[model samples]
Target: MRSHGIVLHSLRYGDHRIIVDIFTEAAGVVPFIVPQSRIGRNGIKASAWQPLALVEVAWQPNVKTALQRPKELSLWQPWRTLTIEPRKTAMSLFLSEFLYHALRREQENRPLFEFVTKALSWFDERDDQFVNFHIVFLLHLTRFLGFLPNVEDWEEGCYFDLQAATFSRVRPYHIYYLEPEESALVPKFLRMDLRSMRAVGLNHALRHRALEIVTEFYRLHIPEFPESRSLEVLAEVFE
Candidate 1:
């Protein structure tokens, strides 16, 4: 079968072979085994399996096997600076790890796939003003995951209830809620896009805090969402 996918992450298998987790448009999230000989052949280097690298893959599907080997692979798009730029690379790494965890067991979700592909291209086109990208991405990603926070009651005195995924005039007694200041910002994120990112007034502190809130929101919705290791790397880069 022929499919297009975004490379989520790869693990070194034995010495020269590698196993790649891909979120494919046709087959959802599937693992692909790339043997030693195929890695560097036809400009498809092993390094090309980097996080969020778009690729067109031809592979045979077998009912008995979990991992499918690609017969043909090619870069779907050559990202100009995502891999080379420092902060962008950091953001992509964090996002890649986030997506791997978020979409690991997903079935074929076309809308979700389209959203991710469009967002990656958006990142590629933007330069340094993408500090809020991941936070925004995570916020929107919730819609697909089925826990998108409700900003319907967003007003001057409203607090966002993460656990209930709703907004309320009365503050929740639990800890899984955002403060007024933080809650006020949730409405902005509800309509955020890459084109409007530069207009956002977030500094390093606000960005970090927003990230914390969003990550916590994810934790509330997703069972056992572990602490992201790439987070520290992102913080350092932003600092």
Candidate 2:
């Protein structure tokens, strides 16, 4: 079968092969074994396996095993700056890690795949003023993952119930909730798309806080979502 996918994670399989977990439009998350021989001049380049690299992949399905062998693989959307620009590279790394965990059990959902591809392409093409891109991306991602916060229910001085995934005028007894001040930012963020995100300026401290809250929100919703190590790297890069 042939499909377009985003490279999520890859690791050395033995000495000669690497196993890549890709979130494909057709197969959700599928691991493909890429042999060493496929790395030379006449075959698929190693760079095509990089995190978040969009690629067209052809693989044979085997009912006996979870792993699939790629018959053909090539970059479907080569990024111009995402791989080279320092900040963009950092963001991509963090996102790739986050998605690996977030979509671990995801089944094939073409709309979700399209949303991710379009968002990443926008991020790659953006020249500057994309500091809030990741936060916005995470916020929007919940829409497809089925835990999207109800921004429409938001009102003045409403507290956001992270566990409930909704806004409440009264604070819940549970601790997993955002205070009104922090909660106000969600509706604002929900309103901002990739292009408009630049207009809502946030200082480094506020941005950091927002990111932390968002991460915690994910932890609450996603089962066994571990803290992302690349998050610190991304923070340092932005700082």
Candidate 3:
């Protein structure tokens, strides 16, 4: 199946090889390798596959339903400014690593793909506070995974229970829950589509709160995923 996708990441397979992972707008996650990807300056080289680079991928299995490769390739973009911005670069790196492990392979997710593309474009355009971008991404991403929690799950001024992925007027059944203020803020973010760089109305403190919510949400749902290491640095930037 041929589709448009964004390169998520690439790492050396052996000594002189590259294993790249890409997420197609329609075809979830696909991974394949390129020979001699680590070749030096004078070799038939494969370009460095950076996170969020767009490409049209032609997926074909080598023999049966075994390992596949992209029969065709092209650069969607280079992300010039984003690659240079220290903060955005760190966030992108953290996000790519998180998705690399969490997103399953060969599933179809048009909405999630659309969200990520929107996010990358936002990173390219604006320079607003970004602590909220990941939080928004995680919230919106739940919809793609069929786990979108209803805001109505809690009435106004209630609590957001992360473990249950629900809401309540009483105390949370679990400790990792969103208080009233955080709950109120979620709907505002859930409605926004712009990137953090383009234009967003978030202060660092609110963004950090959102970040905490996001991490707890990840723990609630994605059991095996580890804690986000970039968050502390990201928090400092927000502060």
Candidate 4:
């Protein structure tokens, strides 16, 4: 089965083999093993299977498939900015980690796929002023994951109740709540898209804080969401 997919992550296995987790149009999320040759084998190159790379994958399905094999693979879109720009690369790494953990289902989600595809393209074309891209990406991603923050309850003096996944005039009695100021940023993110991402104004501290809040918001919603190891690196770049 030929499917277009995004490479979520890849791990090298032993010597010449690599295992990749891909979110595909046909199969949702699936793992594949790639065997590299000595040289000039004309197979998929190791560099080709990069994180968040868009590619057309030829899936080799199995009867009791724990991991599928790719008969062929080709790059779909080459991201010039994301490849060469260090900040964008770091941002992409963080976002890729979030996607790896957040999108757990092995089922097709065309809408989510479409949204991600467009967002990546936007990231590739846009100039360097978009520091808040990841924040907006993380917040908007909640909509597809089925836990979009309840913007309805957003009002003055209301805190975001992470536990209830909504807003409230009174704060929750736990640590999983956002302060009023932090809560206010949620709607700003909700209203943002890739094109208007530059309109969000925040200092280094506030942006970092908002990213933390978004991370916590995801962790609250997704029990298995892993701690983002790339977070510290991303924060450093922003600072």
Q: List the residue pairs that clash in candidate 3.
A: 126-197, 126-198, 127-197
Query: Judged by lDDT, which candidate is best?
Result: 2
Note each model's CA RMSD in angstroms: 1.6, 1.0, 3.2, 1.5
Model 1: runs farther than 4 Å from truth?
none
TM-scores for every candidate against the unseen true structure: 0.94, 0.97, 0.81, 0.95
Candidate 1 per-residue C-alpha lDDT over 1-239 given as tens digits, one digit per residue, 9 for 90 to 100: 88889999899899978899999999899899888777675646765688899988888898899989888777888898899999999999999988888888888999999999998898888867777888888888899999987676788878899899888989899988987888999888877776786678888888888888887788787787877888888999999
Compared with the true structure, the alpha-carbon lDDT of candidate 4 equals 0.85
Clashing pairs in 1: none
Residue 79 miss distance in model 4 (angstroms): 1.1
Better of 3 and 4 by TM-score: 4
Give the alpha-carbon lDDT of every model: 0.86, 0.92, 0.69, 0.85
lDDT of 3 at 147: 60
lDDT of 3 by residue, 95-122 (tens): 7776765674537778778877877776
Q: What is the C-alpha RMSD, rounded to one decimal, of candidate 2?
A: 1.0
List where candidate 2 sits over 4 angstroms from the true fold.
none
Candidate 2: lDDT over CA atoms? 0.92
